[model samples]
Target: MLKFLKIFCASMIASALAFSVAAKEPECTFSATEVYERIADNIVKIISFSIDQHRVLERVRPGIGSGIEIEPGLILTNYHVVQGAKLIGASTNDWAFEAQFLGGDPVLDLALLRVPFYERNFVAPEFGAYNDLDVGQRAYVLGYPLGVGLTLSEGLVSGLDRQIPLNTLSWTTRYIQTDAAVSPGSSGGALLDDCGRIIGLVSMISSHPQAENMGYALPIDSIMPLVGEIEEKGYVSRPWHGLYGQMMTPLIATLLLTDPASVPEGFMVETVEPGSAAEKIGIKGGFLPVMWGFSEILIGGDVITHVNGQPIRSREDALKTVGALEVGDVISLTVWRDGVSLELQAELEERRNFESDLWVNGQR
Candidate 1:
């Protein structure tokens, strides 16, 4: 076995060009030529933060984060990037310098950072838009997937008009669908188009058994605003809504839209917990019923229409419209009840209280 391995090793080295193990990277693995230029040209190392001490030791501490030099010293990354660190990078000649975070938005997972004035300008990566993206479009992911460094993978858009789960005190939701090839450390990375104009930010991947390639990206529409806001306020200003729900399909849509011979779009109430933001505002939910198969097995409840003045055409629309709001906001809702459409006004409520009422822990 040992002799056979040596022969194989000699063959590999001889075939490739007798490369020195100490001087060169592995022949089979990703090569320097594939990345060194890109890394040298684009990749910025994410430096973990060191403890801050002494309020008086002030000497202009630099904040460092991984970034793609969009236009010279102008870098772009997730807000969480330079959250508490200094930005540092290397020059074309391999000379390193410290950069600073100009601004950022945690809500959108995008940020703008600036490198100190240097002799040579850095080339910016292309930004693409998803306005023309279709459900079946071939999507390519370019970023440090798995924190492994610049890598590329391909997958279908799989879906669109997707609303991610809300787990915050403020209502915040956006359109995102699952795709394969996204993983941890990919967050804040670009989910690019073939032209790479910056379609979305790879934000999260799913954790469900049925969810492979169930990754979500913050759409460009939502991310661009964050880039500007972070520049103005050093943070993102998110909107608010009181209701939370899963998307309704055509079947679910029928129940929410109307039962009569006429009506088009809306959402069926899947599960509305008691005393929720929706409940507090007089939203209705279904009563218990036996699961007997039938034409309209979907239980009746509040069929949501417009939230904060936006129409809820489907379950995904309802979630995204409502998730983008903050607490204490007042929103007007158009609901369908018993085949009739009605308008109602509501004020946003804290989710923690509602969650507490949900799990019986008294705290959420």
Candidate 2:
């Protein structure tokens, strides 16, 4: 009888442990249909209207894409989708409304629109933490592909921290690369994680006609700052230091005649705008052009070690540091020059019309 009692107690304990483990396990896996059902109401179809060069009211050809409701009556989409649009209309599964173009960030390919006095309440998607996402994680793309109805496609996070060139603006920006099938009409759709949280907005796919399943999305974190700016100021004014550089590697350091092990990693300055903050502060740009592998790079410029006491480790780090500053704010840079290290200070300037400025400055 005593042995039987002991056996029953062990069985109960084991069952309790099993239940606890099951409770602790995460519910990361989810069904596609369930995700669509939850978010379909917030997904919208955007249509643009404008006048043609012939001075007639014209429906812009292929002026359709997808948008996500970020706030009540406010939707987010791609700038290209609404560019030159005189009138905009948005529709969901059950309702349709006229949308007003609030503002846009062309560089980031983001546009904000509002459906004023919208009667129905909107469910804003929960933004997933971008930094927490990893490659190979399951992802879903929801949009109106090729002017069809709302569609959902599944893929994985194929890459991260990708810098792709925006051919329309002739500038490059970071993107979240995925293998999700995104087509022309799918631009500005939601790229959702397994939890149905939006991690990115579908931007574009590989330009090659034969490229299959290669799509990219603009990470939501990179757009939040611009969104806040647009919400408050109606536009984004990024702080500029008039400096451009490449992240330093061991090979780059050796090519510059520096001991790779001795100096800390940083960005090697390649260009400085004339009469700009960098030039005013005596920050030298590269003088000699050297062929590094297949690419030609400028050498003999200062290696930036820190910005405002924060270590400058990558191009993203430098951009983030400068972007956080307001116009007229002073920033300090610790640089390596002529085999010596020194710190310099410069005031930030507002960068307006970056594309025109890039053209004027002869920067690619």
Candidate 3:
């Protein structure tokens, strides 16, 4: 009888431990209606109007997208929403105001606006770190789709750190992929986490006609640095070195006839714009194009190892290092060329329409 009692006690203990663990787990399910009620007032419908050169009203475009007031008198939305708009207006549940476009980063599809006269209490969205998010975590999207009033959709983070091209801007950007239902009028809405914090800004949806619930958002973390720049200068004066390159990998190192383990990973220069900082500093672009396993990569160019004393392992590392520099700041780049390592210095210039210039030049 004592043996049987001991076995029963063991079973009871296991059951209690399991129950404790289950109780300690966080509740993943949340009411969409409750979330909408809590944040609906924070979301605003953006109306953009196109005006002619004579300043006459041309056309009224309603429901361009939704925006959020990130601070008192400050609004955040997508750049494309107000790309060519002459007049921008925003409306909350009970208030309407005119907003002035302060600045935008087309590469990131982020725009900052100022509601100069708005004095009422505005919701300052709490931003959450993208790094803290995990795949399969619940995500909620709030916006106006198809010109319909405020709508909320729920989904999971399908992917992260996805690279997508923005054909409108002739550039590409990183995005957080989600299965949330987003439509034409959802471009500038907010992607909230389970705690109702802003984690990303809704950007685009899949182009496939049959695609459903495939949407992408610009992660807030990536745009935080640019926000500060826009606030201070009214625009982002992004610094540029005038070079195009790709991050070097082990296979690239092998193709260059260098030991993959011996060479430090960095950007391998492919094209250096003529008369730019890179060319002025004697940086060479690739001389020949070669195919390695069906991927064509330009060979015989300098491999950048470091920027401003920081080791660059990826494109993000190089961009971050450059983005922090002011125009006219001299940046030092360590490069590997002809089996010899050398340090080169270049003064950053204010970035212009480099992409368009490249495209125009390619046609010639």
Candidate 4:
């Protein structure tokens, strides 16, 4: 009887423990007021200063932006905010702290700053499950807009995996689109979920008057992995092969006014960045430029038939294969040049900066 009693007591205790654990988990949903109250202190104001030693100082009005505290003493902001700044600072209503630029990636528009002595008193934010998020979910934006005080705005997620073009170069990082009202200074702010967890980093807003209220943010899920690498090495080591082009199709041949049979179906090499792996492998780019739709395409370059052993039929396939590669990895390419098939091999290298190269269609 005593043995049975003990076993029953143990079962009851286990049930109670399970209930306790479940009760400790915070609710997945939170009200707007609850979210603001929870994460208000996590948002910060960024000050960017451009110093000229030659000029006598009158009054230096710094550029204003927003940032979010990712960890104690570590703040994350847009790279453009502090891109060429001589000095940077982070501020709250009470305390102003001098910030040091730790490391950043221009392509991702992410920068990490460190406030040497400041320690956060509030609880660290939990990252929202980005994969679980769906369209029409509640999205709250917290930032210092127009150099004014901290503001909170709420809206629904309008879209996901949005690929917005940045000048001549296409933004490789897909952004999350929200209807939340973000302004000039709202860059580098936090885009929070209903549970007060960060899901995206507010980057830019639609500048066109017709497209008002459209704000885009970098997915926090993508940035989180790069954040660790930046913390470790001061920058993201993105692999660079320096081959930029579009996939040759029947439509392209039609647009080029060439016979479809003569132009092979493969990745058409447009321009290879100088000193890149593609150039090292003796790959050639097109010399004849033709207007295809809104964009210009070169017609006389080598067509990549295969990479390693896999067929290169679409641009997506090439991107997937190259994106999986790391620096120093060897790659073999099969190219068709003037009715001759040539096999070439090269090792990948690290991409440091492509901001200046963007004007020349430098995307790899």
TM-score of each: 0.57, 0.76, 0.74, 0.77
Superposed model 3: Cα runs more than 4 Å off = 1-29, 51-63, 116-121, 165-174, 206-213, 252-264, 271-275, 286-301, 314-320, 338-340, 353-364
Q: Residue pairs in steric clash, candidate 4?
A: none
Q: Which sequence of candidate numbers ranks them by lDDT, best first?
A: 4, 2, 3, 1
List ranges where model 4 is wrong by over 4 Å.
1-28, 52-61, 117-120, 167-171, 208-210, 245-253, 258-270, 284-305, 313-316, 336-341, 355-364
Residue range 1-364, candidate 1, lDDT tens digits? 0000011121222323522222222222433343233434655544434335655566445432334555666666655444545433422234456556676644344567666656765566645555666655555555564445566666656556553333332123454554548655555555655344456766555453333455667676666645655667766554433343333445444444455445446655544545556666677766534232211132566667676678777545754655566767888888877668888887766443222211111210
What is the alpha-carbon lDDT for the whole of candidate 4? Answer: 0.74
Per-model C-alpha lDDT, please?
0.51, 0.72, 0.69, 0.74
- Report model 1's TM-score to 2 decimal places: 0.57
Arranged by TM-score with the best first, the candidates are: 4, 2, 3, 1
- Backbone clashes in candidate 4 total 0
Best by lDDT: 4
Candidate 3 at 282: error in angstroms?
3.4
For model 2, give the 10-residue run with minimal summed lDDT.
1-10
